[model samples]
Target: MNDETIPQITDSHCHLDFPDFEGKLPDFVARAAEAGVTRMVTICTKLRNEPNVRAIAEAHAPIFYAAGTHPMSVAEEPMVTVDQLVALSAHPKFVGIGETGLDYHYTSDSAQVQKQSLRRHIEAAQRTGLPLIIHARAADDDMARILAEEHRNVPYACVMHCFSSSADLARAALDLDFYLSMSGIAAFPKSQELRDIFAAAPVERILVETDAPYLAPPPHRGKRNEPAFTAHTARVGADLFGLDYVDFAAQTQQNFDRLFAKAAQYKAAA
Candidate 1:
């Protein structure tokens, strides 16, 4: 196929800085380009890792980045202040505020600390005018409550990264004009119910991701994921939205543009 005929998509969330692909980011990004995944946002889950994560984004034109203390590490890392996150956002490639939110499944013991961390991240996003990247796990109720509560305090844009939560949480996130990011898990055959939720959502409110070095889509399931696999999940998204590959790809890029405007604008100016 002619390269120009291929549609473009973005991997809204990934972790290219991790050791899984050490010394091989250029090759992985090349693979993503071949797959029509022309862009990605590599998340920095710890402040201490921000420099390295930012380097990854700086090293490749197709990449952008976000940073915040992940929920699981809330207790282990020093608590982040809103001012610190706000300061980081001043960087040109720093596109969002967090991979933060409540994750009760494995780290329920630190729920209170997680909430405090989440609130602080939310404040940073609010003050910086950047979207918040949320990671919701088994704490849907609290997650929903806190997100809604935080919005009431001060509104900010966000995307429920790798969203596979219940319909209630989906509804809550959507009601706030936030977005739902589709990941490899949504393409799993047994995830009919979750797919239904995406089908029920507005196309403009949906974004596609690989959550790379994590959830690889079908045909690559049970394998280590990378931004390149985002194309596979996006093909599934096309099916759910009842659109062709090109149209679906266009719509998602537009949705991503709307949610992560900093990334879109940065790319445009480049």
Candidate 2:
């Protein structure tokens, strides 16, 4: 289909600063636009990389960014402070607080530091009024408990970015009025269980992403992913929700606008 007929969507999470896209961002952004992925949030997984990631957003109108010390890197990176994260939010394109949360899959040893970092990111989200982007893995119980506990202290918005977690965790996040971002992983053949979890969610709370350089949906699976492939995952999201591609795309755009209000406002003002 042509641009007018294409169903526009946003890649709510990605990593454009990764070496996989180095020196090729313009082409990737162009390809994404061509594929109806009109906007994308490129994430900074380490505090030190925030400048590079922020520069990418500053250089590309269609790109926005979020920064946090990822759970896996919590052991290696300096623990992020709420003040540091809150300070970063001053940038017009700095949109979210994290890609934080628990990840016992590989970094189980650093659980305490991860938890500490997660809370700081949550507090940053609370302070900045930006959604906390989460990356939950095998630590669902702790993840859910902390989120629920802290949310009770002072509610904060969040999205389980590239979510491929348990139904219980999904429910916990949804219970707190948080969003669940569908990445290319949900489009995998063996991801029926994940799809089912998403299928059970309120459509108004669903968003879509690519998680580029990883989790490329079918037809591009096992290859480096990019924001352009968001349309592929979103097509599957449309099918799972029993809605036409355009309608589902529009719904997700509405959901994104509601959650990432800063980006939405930027677009509106532009």
Candidate 3:
């Protein structure tokens, strides 16, 4: 397809602040624009790194950001307060609350701390009205339970980033009106089951991401991933939902506008 004919899409979560892109940010963002990726939400998983990550977004017109203490870093970093996170949201380009949620896959030892951090982020999301960017791994049960418990107290919007979890957890998120962001993992040829999970989801509740500097999709699977690869995963999403590239791209773009209202308004006002 020609560049002019290609529909735009958003990479809802990524990590461009990591060393993997050191001196190549402008080139990386240019490549993403060429791929029809008009916007990206680069996540700040640790509060201490928020300034650096926020700088990257501020420097690049195409990039927006979110920040909070990541679950794996919960034990290492000082606890983040809801006031601190709400203050971060005051920045024009700060769009979401976290890459925070449960991640027992590697950090089960700090489950207690992780849970506390997750609630703190959830509270911040509720207080700020920004959609929570979640990262759930092997702790599905706790993830579901805590999210539900928190929602009962005060509702907040969220998206399960890089969703490769089980059907039950997917249902848990969907039941709570949360979105599911498709990543390179779902585009792997061996992931038919994961494709099926997304296929069953409402088209309007879907978003796409790269989580880059990681999860590079096929043909580039073993290599470093970047925002430009978001289109590659979106292609797989089109196939999963039995739609053509343009239509699927439009659908997901509308989905992103609804969930990331701050970014939508930022673009409109800019």
lDDT of each: 0.95, 0.95, 0.95
Worst 10 residues of 1 by lDDT: 1-10
Kindly list the per-residue Cα lDDT of model 3 for residues 1-270, writing each as its tens digit.
788987999999999999999999999999999999999999998888999999999999999999988899899999999899999999999999998999999999999999999999999999999999999999999999999999999999999999999999999999999999999999898999999999999999999999998999987998999999999999999988899999999999999999999999999999
Can you give the lDDT of residue 240 in candidate 3?
84
> Residues 1-270, candidate 2, lDDT per residue (tens digit)?
888889889999999999999999999999999999999999999999999999999999999999999999999998888999999999999989989989999999999999999999999999999999999999999999999999999998999999999999999999999999999989999999999999999999999999998999999999999999999999999999999999999999999999999999999999
Give every collision pair in model 1: none
Model 3 lDDT-worst window of ten: 1-10
State every prediction's TM-score relative to the real structure.
Answer: 0.99, 0.99, 0.98
Tens-digit per-residue lDDT, 1-270, candidate 1: 666778999999999988998999989999999889899999999999999999888889999999999999999999999999999999999999989999999999999999999999999999999999999999999999999998998899999999999999999999999999999999999999999999999999999998889989989999999999999999999999899999999999999999899999998899
**Error at 189, model 3, angstroms:** 1.7
TM match of model 2 to true structure: 0.99
